[model samples]
Target: MMILVYGGSGSGKSAFAEKKITELNKSGIPLYYLATMQVYDAEDEERIKRHRMQRAGKGFTTIEQPKDLGNIALELREAKSDILLECMSNVVANEMFSDAISDPSIYDKKVSEEKSFDKYEGVFNKIKDEIIKLKDSCNNLIIVSNNVFEDGNIYDDETMKYIKTLGDINVFLAEISDEVWEVVAGIPVRIK
Candidate 1:
């Protein structure tokens, strides 16, 4: 079963997703917590630490796979497992720079040739295909994602590309998911 849970930041969606995954685990398979967040700052580090604490006794073996999801199934061949993709936003953001399109910290005077739009589409497409393969490799797949499309704000082209790509991803997953949920103010509202 592919369950997709999504909401705004601080919407308690992650906790909800974990609970659902734990409840749906019937085969006693390994629960794989796919952590996609890249720690680039102290705040990011602390957030990861806090998430660890929250899931300390959840009986999950965390796998840090940020770029490639297809290889994840290869890592645990023939062993039945359940997977929970922590969030799609981070994965999308990391893939945006997967090709070294542009790095603000390293490149002061940017001179790149790669098309950001083409590169990002390729990244998203790969993620989509791998996610389908991952579903076949696992007993159940619980995906967590952020709902950032509702915010009314103007962003630069790069940020817009990320948002648009993530939006497309969410729509695609919603169509394929067995159940879809949207958590608001710590309350989960089932959308599908």
Candidate 2:
């Protein structure tokens, strides 16, 4: 069952995903949790560590991949493991330069030398392919992504682009997923 869950920040997406993982583990199915966050700060590291500890006794194999989810998915395929990609939004954010939005110069400066459009499109393609592969291979693949479309002025250039890219990703994943859910106040309501 490939379940794709989305929710706004502070809407309990992570907690819901963890709960679902726990429920799946109780059924004697092997569970693998794939986390794609790259912790750059002390707070982020600590938070991620706490999340790990939360699943310590839950019989889950946790794989932390900050980038290259394709490689991680391929490894899981080799092992024939049931995996859950906890989130995708962070994966894109990790691959993109941290200052890409704040300082467009980092990317714009390289635009002349390299086609930024093609580069980003390639990145999107790679991620999309991995998502499709995981959807096909895993018994229970749960994808957690943020619901960022509910607010903010999406007309701004950088923000609009980011929203559109993520929206495309969400739509593509939803099309492949067996179930699509949206969580609000820790309650999961099926959207599709």
Candidate 3:
């Protein structure tokens, strides 16, 4: 089974996703938490720490795969374990902006204008394919993503590209997921 949980920041989406995983594991199957956020600053560190505290004693074995989601299938020890991916926003950002996957020159104004934001379509397709592979490798896959399109503020070209890529990936996830949920103010509202 595959589930997608989405919400804006601080909407208790993670908690709700965790609860759903626990509920689904009635047979005591191994639970894995695929931590996708990379710590780049003190704020990032603090947020990761808080999430760690929240998952304490939850029987989850953490697998830190900030990029290359498909590679996680090789890192898992058990074949029938359930996996929860905390967020897709970070995954998309990591893949889209990383010097490893994308040329650093892409950010240069001259280069950006020449290449156009359409370059992100490749990143979007890569993420979608990796997610499908990961889901196929696990017994159950639960993905938590942020609803960042509601801010209603225009951003710079680079930021807009990242937002659009994540938004597209979220839509793809929702379409493929067996269950879809939107959490608002700690309430889990089923969307599918």
Q: Highest lDDT: which candidate?
A: 3
RMSD of 1: 2.3
TM-score of 2: 0.82
Off by over 4 Å in 2: 26-29, 98-108, 111-116, 154-156
- The order by descending lDDT is 3, 1, 2
Tell me the TM-score of each prediction against the true structure. Answer: 0.91, 0.82, 0.90
Model with the higher lDDT, candidate 1 or 3: 3
Ranked by TM-score, top first? 1, 3, 2
Give the CA lDDT, 0 to 100, for residue 28 in model 1: 61
lDDT of 2 by residue, 150-185 (tens): 775547454555566778889988998777889999
Q: What is candidate 3's lDDT per residue for 1-192, written digit by digit as tens? A: 999999999999999999999888756678899998877689989999899999998888898988898788766535778999989998998887665335556456444355566679989988888888888788888999999998899997778888989989999999999999999999999999
Worst 10 residues of 1 by lDDT: 105-114
Model 2 misses residue 2 by how many Å?
0.3
